[model samples]
Target: MLKLLNQLLGLFCCFLMTACSSVPKLESNAIAPIVKLPNNHEELGVMSAYSDPWEGFNRRMYYFNAKADEYVILPVVAGYQKITPDVVERSVHNFFSNLDEISTFINSLLQLKLFVAGETLARFTLNSTLGLAGLFDVATQIGLAEQNEDFGQTLGYWGVDAGPYLVLPLLGPSSLRDATALAFDNLVFQQAINELGLDTDEELLISLIDGVDARASLPFRYYASGSAFEYEHLKLLYKKYREIQVAR
Candidate 1:
């Protein structure tokens, strides 16, 4: 059990070094196909109004995460993608995304987004039932678009300061609030699956599947950002993205 937990932790740290929030909000005027921290957000994401005091530590962790992704994480994801049929892959993606709405639903209420909480409930209901347990994304087709919410965003909504940038050992870039939120969310999530009848092993396996699916969906590659300044660029983008998420 300890070995499996360690392996899963390593996989998560390596595979997902990006995005506290889901992929950035879509924009009609956005130029980037991936839509992370839209260039237009010069007020914050272009550069930080605040400073990264721990940039030295962040840079080392960034390098470590990049190498891990290249050598361990991406290779595994590639193999999984190669073997899985596209339809099956899509189904796996949707199923996990649907399950994530449970967190979104709770976080929406925390953030006091009553309309969004309601929307999340409706989306979860429609997807789980009409969408075949979220394997088909029927909710999206019907217009109850999935909204990503998390405790980090909840704190932000409540006017909690981000309180300096910090990169977690396996979690990559995050503020103090987001990092703490991550830990709390994991605890809540574990209890949730426990109630749903997942044994520890089954829960770990499911988490693995979800992580892989999310990594597979991203358009970016580790250390392949095509610029020597990629790290700086990512910092700016992450800041901008999170700011938008908070203020939006």
Candidate 2:
């Protein structure tokens, strides 16, 4: 048991180092600050207006994530990209995306966005069957565009305040509301996997593949933003992005 626990910790630490939130009234000021760059672009007063109450812990986590990404996750991702054919990679992405539509559909319904829910349902149905288990995104070709909805957004839609900007280990940026939402989503996902009769080993394999695939798809690199205050900028971006998502 101890050996297994250590292995899991090591694996999570590897992920934590590789990458890199939120909220009150779901307001911008509560979670992040508006970053203003002067004409010379040399001065940034981001921290002065920033609302990262957990700045000490958050910055430490960010530093750890960046270093891990540089040494571990990025290399693994690069290797995966190198060995996998483009077409194959896209199919893997599509397959997972089709699975994600299930969560999105449910969240959309919870948020009372019936149209989006229906659309996601159609996308899932079409892609699962005609798209050959989502190896292809046939739904998008016909105008059933993919919609991004999650439990966090559902919470935001229901007026749950983002508790604070939180940097989650291994998972990266999130707010209190979003983090709770994430736990709920994970429970739902695990239940679905169980319903599908996936064994524990099979489930773990799929999760690793999903994580690798996700990392490959993301173009963002830690510390690559060329800013001394990358943490502040990332915080602001995440906050603003969630704001838009919740508003939508």
Candidate 3:
């Protein structure tokens, strides 16, 4: 009887521990205070004011994207609601690899790294050809690992300090130096776009469609989180991750 009682007690304790572990903790909605600009108060003030419209635009865009993401993820969650973390992690890794290849290709062309550019071009072409136009993973098979360098990293490479944090409309988080770098990058991209001429509209349209499709692909992962707060937490995590990448 004592042995049976002891077994019962152990089972009860295990139940209590499992229940405790399943309880969700309440999280506070506190964000770190943004850093300020030095010796550029007036300029920052103007930029801040200008940024207001963009913030609204970005908020709307974010909302739309969130809604679209929810729609895309619904079917996935319905079928794979209990998918393992390792599987989800692999999907994230694959997504980043695809993005990195695109970034590397653009950067190599702009930076005039002929060898790197050639490699990127070859990788991109092969991926598009065999990977079903970059919707698959052909680059990984050929040993061409993805590489990513944003405008912020480009600026950092040139010894630019990341000035005060500035949240721009539609574009999201950025620093002063990064904003300048973005403008320069956009200018270069525009030159390339212009060089392609009127006949390239179909290609441009296809590229834009591909971008939208890619953005829509991750909605299910966000939806599985169960709340807006959880989604925002994930976003902040991504922001911090990107900032670390820039700093490096």
Q: Top model by TM-score, which number?
A: 2
What tens-digit string does per-residue lDDT give for candidate 2 at 37-138? 355432333334447788899999988887887898889989999999999999998988888888888899999999999999999999999999889999
lDDT of each: 0.73, 0.75, 0.48
Shift in Å, residue 161, candidate 1: 0.6
Please say which candidate is ahead in TM-score: 1 or 2.
2
Worst 10 residues of 2 by lDDT: 1-10
Provide the TM-score for each candidate, comma-separated: 0.78, 0.79, 0.45
Which residue pairs clash within candidate 2?
Answer: 17-65, 17-68, 17-69, 18-69, 21-165, 22-165, 23-162
On lDDT, the stronger of 2 and 3 is 2
Candidates sorted on TM-score, descending: 2, 1, 3
Off by more than 4 A, model 1:
1-48
For lDDT, the strongest prediction is: 2
lDDT of 1 by residue, 133-170 (tens): 78889888878877877788899999998887876664
Tens digits of per-residue lDDT, candidate 3, 43-72, equal 443223222234454456556655654575
Please give the lDDT score at residue 155 for candidate 2.
Answer: 92
Tell me the TM-score of model 1: 0.78
Model 1 clash tally? 0
